[model samples]
Target: MRKVILSGMLCCALTATFTIDAVAANSALVSPDRRISVALFIDAHDQAQYQISHDRQPVLLASGLGLALSDRQFLNNIRSIKPSDITEINEHYQLYSGKQSQVDYSANQQQFVLTNDKMQQLEITFRVSNDGVAFRYRALEDKRIDKQSPKPVSVVEEYTRFNLPQQSRAWLQPIAEAQTGWEHTNPSYEEHYQMDIPVDQPSTSPAGWVFPALFKIGNKTDNTWMAITEAGVTANDHASRLQARSPKGEYAIGLPMAAEVFTGKALLSHDTLPLQTPWRVIAIGSLATIADSTLGTDLAEPSAMDTRFIKPGIASWSWGLLKDDATVYSVQQQFIDHAADMHWQYTLIDADWDQKIGDDKLKQLVDYAAGKNVGIWVWYNSSGAWNTTKYSPKSRLLTAETRQQEFAKLHNLGVKGVKIDFFAGDGQSMMAYYHDILNDAAKYELLVNFHGTTLPRGLSRTYPNLLSAEAVKGFEMITFFQEAADKEASHSAMLPFTRNLFDPMDFTPTTFNDIPNIKRKTTNAFELALPILFVSGIQHIVETPAGMKTVPTFVKSVMQQLPTHWDESRFIAGYPSKLAVFARRAGDTWFVAGINGEAEAKTITLDLSFLQTMGGNIEMIVSDGERGFQTHKVVLSAKTEIKLQGNDGFIIRITPKS
Candidate 1:
């Protein structure tokens, strides 16, 4: 029934010969720089399988792809397979709202078109960069006599699986959600990470493991590292996690059977055609390439708004320091004055500001902050309800009209940004709401920050005003749990490689206080380095004006001038739950932070070659054991070894000496 055809698709670094069979075909593509390659083949039955390699060494085993629909039609039949398109994208796009000022988005693109017996089509598009590889599924309309939609297509599950070699291992954080009195099916993306976990091992959680799964492909130094994450996330789609598959297939893209319930209503996504899914990405290369991969942003849509008004900087938050008791104007003014004193850009006036201060008084506070040369960021509950047990405020911005009105009011009130909290989950309805809010927020010139919501999947790229998100087990957890500060050292070490892979984390960094009244587990130096170590478009650090006076003068200086984004980022040493060392350059100046997780002292050898040629003298500060916060004058060189105490941290600032 099908004709056999052979063709060749020439890529940037290599040419893949396509061989056609009675039912399927096979081909291969390589990364633009010739470091990575993927071999794709369709069997006689029309099922598609792909494998990845680095420098000619197999890194990813053969993996199948398909999507199952509720209509009893499996989109597994490869009706026809051939080269779709090849493009070379080389451009530097600026993020009006992100941690990095500019991003280098360059990749070589290739695609494969697959169709089923029902005449329906699914296109798999792949982009290979020098550092990573990404692919996404786009559902197309069937072209046969009765193949179009009005009678739409609904997908139940995506049958994409990640099969790994037997020796490979992953750094996993099992996804969990509570189902009953004692347990949950999803961890709400709050669980601690388990490092170097074998891929074949069994896990207890049925919901599977949280994505952005980092894998160590082999023992080689140059070519065998990989990180699996998703991009181009939309509200129209549900979250995807990796579940263990036995007997051969190592892991799979799993569908969460349960939905998130808000106000007693369950939220689930029923994706329909004319639909496209998020990009499933694999960053493959050396650890440095995998650590600093920007493929996620490449997979996300570009900025949809004018970003001039949406500037990125740090905000002095009131909630972490004063909590509910500080809702009044005087306390809020103290925060503003504190932010102003430190020359920080913004002051966040948290929840209940409306009820506590009222309109006439709130505007005066906004005016006062403006006079201090500081911007205002007010908090609003996205659903508009505070608590179920007590009286709740009606959601004023649920609809388009209300959102426009509310945003206009804030813009008129001179508010720079809005921190919207408590999203329902990753549902089509909620994701649609995100798009609407961002579109409307731009109209009022209001910058945005998402709190108590889903992890970023390149939304910040699409909406630069959407600055930061609180989606992980951040410092705030200490407010409720006693064990929080104890786990701070280890948890902090794991973030950069895992939770921070695809988005800016608002974990609302804490520097003034480690935890209320718990002997500070991490030293003052460690606390101080956070503003630099943690990457957020808006580094919302929690430290009151009075409390901030106790910090070292230079630490305060660095905090005040800390660039929320960077020109470059490099991973230096250590793995999850062990150590994390990194260097970031904002311009001529370089900032570096390193923290140790174990209880014993350890030394790290840092490579300063990135700062080479740009001659600069280094001024270093460390928080090792009881050394307190002391500055050391050290000569700048390519290699420097430093020691840290158990539960310690180190930070250094490099400036060119005249």
Candidate 2:
């Protein structure tokens, strides 16, 4: 074991790990690969601050760190600072969801102990990994004080900051004001992103910005891409967002809104002694590294329950296209048959199933689907005083008893999962409510999908039963509004790098057929590419059976064989909100997919040498203008040129040579 101790004097260097016993004002913890470093120090004003750099290039400037408790300020007026020995951590974990099935995690960790003038002790721990860094804090009780019965302590505010460089650019989604949007169901993390804006720009939403926030620092030639988010958020903690005001490019953490709590629950977070906050993760590197990094899940708590009932597959959802009328028994039966015909594992019966389809008919439909080896999923309104959404099956899941009763009934009806929608914002109470629902659902062996909800924030790893969450402004928005459709290309392109980086996003991707009363902007090829491009545990596809009949046979075959759970994923090419290209593998087959988000046709040349080294046969399926597909066999080479039509996409499937 190696240690770097910081006592009272400032020290900065790029050296290998060695034991140093000296009084230092600052301590630098370098990554295992030595390419990333985090500096933790107490400044001249006696305030705790930190900095991050990649390859000696500044990624985040000196940022303040501390929090205010109801009793007093925690990190200010630091009396003494002591550092612990550096511990090397190397481990491997397996997950059934997200971009990869198995992950190898390596990091170097050190703890900083600080005591304020009030004799309050706070421990801040930093873990530096090759791809990025993560830090968290624990408020401890001082042994000198007389021990008494512990009482709840409120977290007044956190002063953590992420100060970007002046020239840095950002792509962030402004969180909606609580109780503002449709039926007071605002701040669902569904707002559109402000693409490639300056880091100093204030957010349009007075509430703040949502995570994971993407940024590009340094000059264009020497740019370092980064994303900021939090993980391992348990019910003991409240979820947070970026504060709206960023004075001098310094972004602070903001707690949830007053109305963001569950009805009759606390808005602020309260906990007893030894309070541990969630890990603040900053993924820093090239765009590829940012896309491929699993720091979010890497810092999260492992799965708590069995995953035998967790199955990853696609679902045929008619509500995205057919609306409320599609909830009828006949239409649902058609979708079940459609799923069976396409070899999909599930068919989703959306909102209003209780009144429209009724219990008797829904049971028959479930039995019918089961006979064909297909499962059924239903929807519910997270109804209470939280939102005024008039959807049916409401008020059935506001309490644990009622929620479990509903889940038990659904399990008896052969329902595989439940899509709970229209939740309140990210208050501590609502965060606990999310965990409650997942826990109750898991008891009855049911999968969970949250809509109109907060970001998963690595919950899929914590609870394997949680397959996906609809935090993005999904395809349902595109079907209802023309403006949303117009911005579809760019918004979809941004998700792979930002929203969908680690979480399983239920974007309800792909609709090759034209939507009613809305002009479809993305080409069929772009829509075709989505199934492979987007990663979701239970991908609820929006295309109808009639729409499927219009595509080429090869395209249909590719859709049928798409894998929801991937063995490995790599970023091949492209930029944020403009173009995205990715290669994902399942077993021995590889699926290379890309989309051009610009209005003009874009040409992309991919380096297929990595895939070629494995010796495989390739088939390229690309767009033929707006509504058709062009399929052909291609030879893998070092450089392969691919021309994508405006608002178009392509997918290249590689199989091991027989």
Candidate 3:
């Protein structure tokens, strides 16, 4: 029979006892052969619905928490559920039916266990080590529901709900505020708007799916209980509303409880509990590195994967993207010819080299690039159908499988890397897709450069092949967009504090002497200093081949000498969006770049204390003032102090004089 239970007992001062009376909800229902038990209790007196009841009988407030259940439906045709499956466990811990009883708690503090006459069992745990408490519950071995699916699988669904203490209004309010913030800033704007339900009248509100809300209890002054469903389930209907019983004797329905579930066998299935109350789980480090690393590091000490996979180089497109294929090929050859002269390791062939995916055209370019002792990196689209009417349909590697194969083919062709583009940050699904791409590319030993994508997040640590991500509003726009030049100074200063915290950023440094607009600032010398200023594994010396040939002697000298790897880094001065100074080390040499956003000059002294520890005579390469971004390169002797002007910058590379 379907029975509802109510139990309670009061402790003198520190402890409380709870006894539940099993009341039949439906007498005709038979108890399942195997059942899982889950329960929650509210102890705080401040909550509006601090306690729960059945048929006017007060249920036991075993702990300061509550329980609720959601009915999950299983779809027939789905295959393996990868990490991308968010529909079931949006952000809450989901318990899948399994024989394992070992519970793994996300945040466990206190523990409670109860079993009823029908073999129904419940386990509840709370963690309160930090400022807040986390409650988790698991109901096991419920009657299995049978469903006919195209694939063979067992389906089990249970009635899930939380048991809360009486008088829980104050504790519930902050939960409402946190939920509001979560919904407001949710990545899926439409989903957030649709999921918003009126707390008092959820029935009349528009029913649309949104992420589940966290259940809360207790007042801020004493303690607060917080609980969130693991990721997967969506809140779509009024069926998920939060029900509350008032302190005096009133019952009201609140907003729906947020919930998530997991369907695959790989998901762990145990109800977890903690020995204490209030616990904190923090994932720290650079957000960019986390974004880039498919396999995220522990919250602390996040770093890029080993640099052994990185083959430092210069690319052609970054130096110059030409309309004429022959000119581009000739320029590439010339760059290769001077590779030893400039200390560059690689040359890239941008888009349009391949007439088709398996065409001999790419093969020819690969052969030529290899003969020059330079590595070749080709470009490809993230996803797009090639148009034969406009270009060559045979050239497209459209599907994921096809792209994977093409990457392998490129690797076989001795292409060192591939540049991928046009990945708009769609949602969690797209994020998963990108992660898969990076993993697959790893198998082929292909270095990856992501263009037109979101900011990096140290994914390079997990996949060192992921060389750089281009999310900056950078120099490319300067030639066509007038606003680009105006914003360049400020944007450069802002990135180090914001984006660079994660991983290598592909800013495509050193665009000098090629500014189309005279009113704007751009020059060869400015470009020469950029490699030392920007921290990217793949440093691009972007300029026309003709421009490179025409570049001033001093500017060329600087470009040829800049180093890509660094041993140390320091932030010397300035605001995020104004002016800034940074010094990075590569062995005994140190490279410093200071940028000024305004048009006014400012003087600053170098803190060579770091160098003093190393004890060395510093040889300097200083490019400051308008000359910093000018085509004509100028250098000054080592000095204790340096002065720079607005909309200007400085790049200094110092090595110990032997």
Candidate 4:
């Protein structure tokens, strides 16, 4: 049996509070007495310390039994404690190598320092505010540690293999193999992995696992962690999960929220926290829809927080993969046609647009697109030579002064936005360059879409016109490559909990047809649902006019009707690897999307209780059928029960009926 413990003060404070039953094991009550009885669970062993406190009040609860990794001296001291010395349960939480570590603590340290004899030592300072805490981790090379280093630090590549249960193999087969490694080299060593999880049981909530890995800073190695917080489906509830990936060296002091949420993963590090480093926070609300209504206004831009550079608008190349002049003209025409048909507010032209942007051919295309009630956007390669080849000196707009002058010229030509690309990732000098681009772009009133860059850091709040950025592996690669698809679905599911926590992502959506050679299991309906599922401010429904014609009428209708903004949002249900459901409200209409990562049929139902108070019938548009990719042909009035197929999903648009 799971043990529940309440401190004396907490019990006293909650004497006559309203009693709310645990609807499920994870559910808890926020009592009027200012006490919250969260269903806490932790797996640990030996001398490790785990405690939960509310508003500074300590609560000693039962912790899980497991081995603890700490300083060698500390472990040696605690080894003598018998199993009886610690509370033990019949069923102990098992610890798996590479699985997430369990550690939770709260501190009020003004400055934190981290170092290992083998690596560099860094320092960090924290500032607490009403909203939350803010801090930076910095990396410095220790001459002593550097001299003793074993090898010049390089990334290690690992491939994961898992034998799935026969029932779960169908969806698991595609992505059974993945290559993992860290891509960013910064304040610390970071690693990336691709893996899949299978869900085959029925329960109110699904079992979850935390994944751990080792990161080497100088000569010292620290462990990083990520967890699939929730999985599986439950009746009348949506599925969802939360995941965080950060350096293990700062796990104890770095990750506090990982413990606040009942389910999630963490990396444990015994060393001190690093100083002056910029960490990335991404929180996506839905798997298919990237926009989070609560993100920009309430979270991203808090008045008291430090301001970072911001860029706005969607990337043109994401919507139209134009490699040359002709493709650019063709895509410009398509954008014009689609913009008018879909009431799209802005269109972006990606890189290489200026190769022949000054010629009569290009000018005609721009004029034609503008005439069709569409705005044109051009792309530029940051710091690349723009005056050579098809993009001649005549079309070149170099230097800050020239850039501003050209912005005026483009504005005269009715250009609406600009997609900047090919930013070389170097040191702080490059960082300063990126910031300058954003500042200059703002001067010209040109919305920006940053490609091949760092993650967003709440710049959108300062510049509401800034739309989205592409830091994550997005849908464009799906057009020609199958290499990333297996992890794509799972990665999409993970974003809501990790990457999206920071700001909006420009993960261009709704590519209905697979490009020439790529392997694809997704259908037109699935494509249409992405705009409603992914939390992106500016959405891209990329398809050739001919390809668009081939899409099913219902799918096209749904894509045309999808909205980019929402009034409210909720995570109905899901785990990071199995399934995820998100419901968003845009005025009277509520749009909900359910995406599955596992193989096999699953049932999902949305609670209509929120709608009951409205006291009216609701119109529903649901897509689910024998073919997971096929659109649901029938339009029905609300009844509640809905079924979803494995590796498939549905989009529902509900409006209150008079």
CA shift at 130, candidate 4, in angstroms?
A: 10
Best by lDDT: 2
Q: In model 4, where is the ten-residue run with the lowest total lDDT? A: 94-103
lDDT at residue 141 of model 2 (Cα atoms): 71
lDDT agreement of model 4 with the native: 0.39
Tens digit per residue, CA lDDT, model 1, 50-110: 7777776777776777776555343456665556557787877776434466888888787
Q: Of the candidates numbered 2 and 4, which has the greater lDDT value?
A: 2
- How well does each candidate superpose onto the true structure, as a TM-score? 0.90, 0.96, 0.55, 0.57
Q: Where is model 2 poorest over a 10-residue stretch in terms of lDDT? A: 17-26
Task: Judge candidate 1 against the unseen true structure and give its global Cα lDDT, from 0 to 1.
Answer: 0.71
CA lDDT, every prediction? 0.71, 0.86, 0.42, 0.39
Best-to-worst lDDT order: 2, 1, 3, 4
Q: Alpha carbon lDDT of residue 287, candidate 2?
A: 91
Candidate 1: C-alpha RMSD after superposition: 4.3
Clashes of each: 11, 5, 96, 47
